[model samples]
Target: MAIKNVVVAGGSGALGTPIVNELVKSGFNVTVLSREGSTTTQPAGTTVKHVDYKSVDSLKAAIAGQDAVVSVLGSFAIPEQIPLAQAAFAPGSTIKRFIPSEFGVNTRKTPGSAIGKILGAKTQLVDFLTEEANKNPNFKWTGISNGHFFDWGLSRGLFGLDREKRTAKIYDSGNERFQASNLPFVAKAVSAVLQKADTPDDKTANQYFEIASFTPTQNEVLAAAEELTGGDKWTVNRVSSAEVQKVAEDKLSKGDYSVFVDLLSVWQYADGAGHAPNLADPALGNNILGLGHQDVKESVAAWLKE
Candidate 1:
């Protein structure tokens, strides 16, 4: 069934807003369910229904005629998705696709590893969705595991380069390739997936799709920053990928959960020379979902204020 009349939970959030906008732009009938006291306005022309998120019946009422429910809820509200999922695939519900908030690193890749344990909540949700999809013949779940948010990372210095600080942290030659997606690319990718729901040759019923805007090295990103900020104006800090874990582990021993990000960075920047878990090619999903590609410098430009 081609997905239409879609429902987006947490449609007012950072990632959620863009996904909602793109779905509406792609001509999908978009409905954003706001909480009872939400004062934020959704995108123009979107149908906003304020409902009880705690009650499954209220969720069912809002999701009654929808074809898909894309949950972009933040970390704190993840548990609420159980009720949303229950309402989506209920015995006679119209929803055929349920997409969990999986826009970060591949959580399904490592459940036994440290980062996997830290992200257990997210992976568990996917597991639940999978079981539900198996139980219901008409229902299926889709997961998009894009590595990182490229533009956001650049702007916020998550990839180890602070634009305002005029410094770049170079990790082990700084040329290890990691795939990532920007807000726009991720949004359009979701829209495309929903639009192509269960088509003959482009079936997206129960597939977990991996995608990225571009797979660029840190060196490429640094080059873009250096170019945008004049001839290598930024100070560079050289660091060994091998030493990253010790520092992360030390922090983890202190009960700092923020170390999870450090551990994830270890895999993305250091493990197998940056190719950890060694999964198959992501091009298959990108091709199927029509994500195409973009230049990394373009993304760097936005963050560098160039």
Candidate 2:
């Protein structure tokens, strides 16, 4: 099936915007379903549709006739999986494929650790889609596990680095390497997956697709930054994984969900302990996606320029 038309829920947000832009650049007709009165700009050749997440009918109408739906919508209060499933399986709908807001770790396989607790809600979303796919043969879903957001984390200071201060607090030896993907790389992966929606033999349904750039350690990232900046102007501090996990557990015990989630992400890959099992898929990792090791120094240089 040729997926020419795509609908992106929460397309106005930070991550979704890039995905939508990439899809548009790839010649896919894109539509963005956002909250009513949303002021976010839509990429050229993409339409913005107003649809409330809570309204099944609104969502169904917005998703109608689309070959694929890419959802990056998230809310701390609500699990969006239900609405997404509803829209995909709406009565007489033609939606063939669905990509949930799974842009982090492999929550479905690893659900007991700190990352598990933080991403437990996302697991529920995945389970919802699993059941839906069982009930509807035409319904299929893909989960993108890209380890960490490489460029965004550095530029926006997401991984605890003060971009202005050029300082980062490291965990463990900072020598553990894990795969990371830039936001644009993530967007390209989504576009590739949508482009080949009919190849069910690929076993993409209810399956996790691991997408990554070069797997590098925290020390490596810091070194790249230093090399790019031409000095040791950045300060790197060390923290134990056990200490970070303890703090995450404490926050969860205190009902601070936001801090708990952040800590969970820290515990998942702080020491590069978590491995992407699905990177072995040649179709996803090599042939089809053609994802290769990206230069950290070059990536950081581009980010610093921006």
Candidate 3:
């Protein structure tokens, strides 16, 4: 069946706005499902549907008649899986596709790591979605794993880099390259997926699709920053994997996300060395998604301007 209308839960968020705009540009009648009382404005031609994440009835109403659903919805409070499953399996729905908010790290592979431990709840969401898809053939789900949001991380200090000082904290020797994607790349890939919904050759029912822009090392990032800023005036601080792991352990003992930090620490050291073979889907590489290789130097220059 051809996908015509699509819905996005949490469509008012930072990532959701771009996804909504891209979907609308691709000719899908887009519906933005915001939580009730959300103050964010919807884009033109996109309908705003108020749905409470806690209320299954409200979610079902907003999700009705959509060909597919995309969720960028997240919370440090609510377990997202329940609402996501409810929205996917909304009453009298023919919703064929679902894209979960699995946009960071290859969760399926890093099972025993700090991130895996900290994100145990999110992992359960994946398991639930898989089980749901298996039980109901009418529904399908895709988890897009884009390693880390490169530009977003850089801008937001997520990589422990100070944008003003042009300084970053590194793990190990900081020479290992790791995969990363920009927020725009993630939005484009998601939009491309929804636009090409009928063409299932590049998609699976309940599987993960990994995408990346550049796999640059921390040193390479520093070099790129220096080049972009017109000088080598940046600071680089190094931390060992063991130190990171110990910190993560201490944090986890205190019931925090130190585990996730540790996992990220391990990721810095391991790169893609310990990842699964099919983690990056070449079939969905550059063709269906229009995903092109990004220039890190140019991107950094632009970011510095912003």
Strongest candidate by lDDT: 1
| C-alpha RMSD in Å of predicted model 1 compared with the true structure | 2.4
Q: Give lDDT per model, in order.
A: 0.81, 0.75, 0.73
If the candidates were sorted by their lDDT against the true structure, best first, what order would they fall in?
1, 2, 3
Q: Which ten residues in a row have the lowest lDDT in candidate 1?
A: 271-280
Candidate 2: stretches off by over 4 Å? 75-78, 162-166, 199-203, 231-234, 260-265, 276-288
Q: How high is the lDDT of residue 145 in model 1? A: 79
Cα lDDT for residue 160, candidate 2: 53
Residue 27 lDDT, candidate 3, scale 0-100: 83
Residue runs of model 1 more than 4 Å from their true location after superposition: 253-255, 271-283
Ordered list by TM-score, greatest first: 1, 2, 3
lDDT at 27, model 2:
90
Of the candidates numbered 1 and 3, which has the greater TM-score value? Answer: 1
lDDT for each residue of candidate 1 in 1-306, tens digit (9 for 90 to 100): 377789999999878999999999888899998899889898887999888878899999999988999998877787788888889988779997888888888877868776776778888889998888788778888888778887767666688888777788877877778878898888988888887886676557777877878777778788888898887668889887778878887777687878876787777877354442222464456787766777888778877774
Worst 10 residues of 3 by lDDT: 271-280
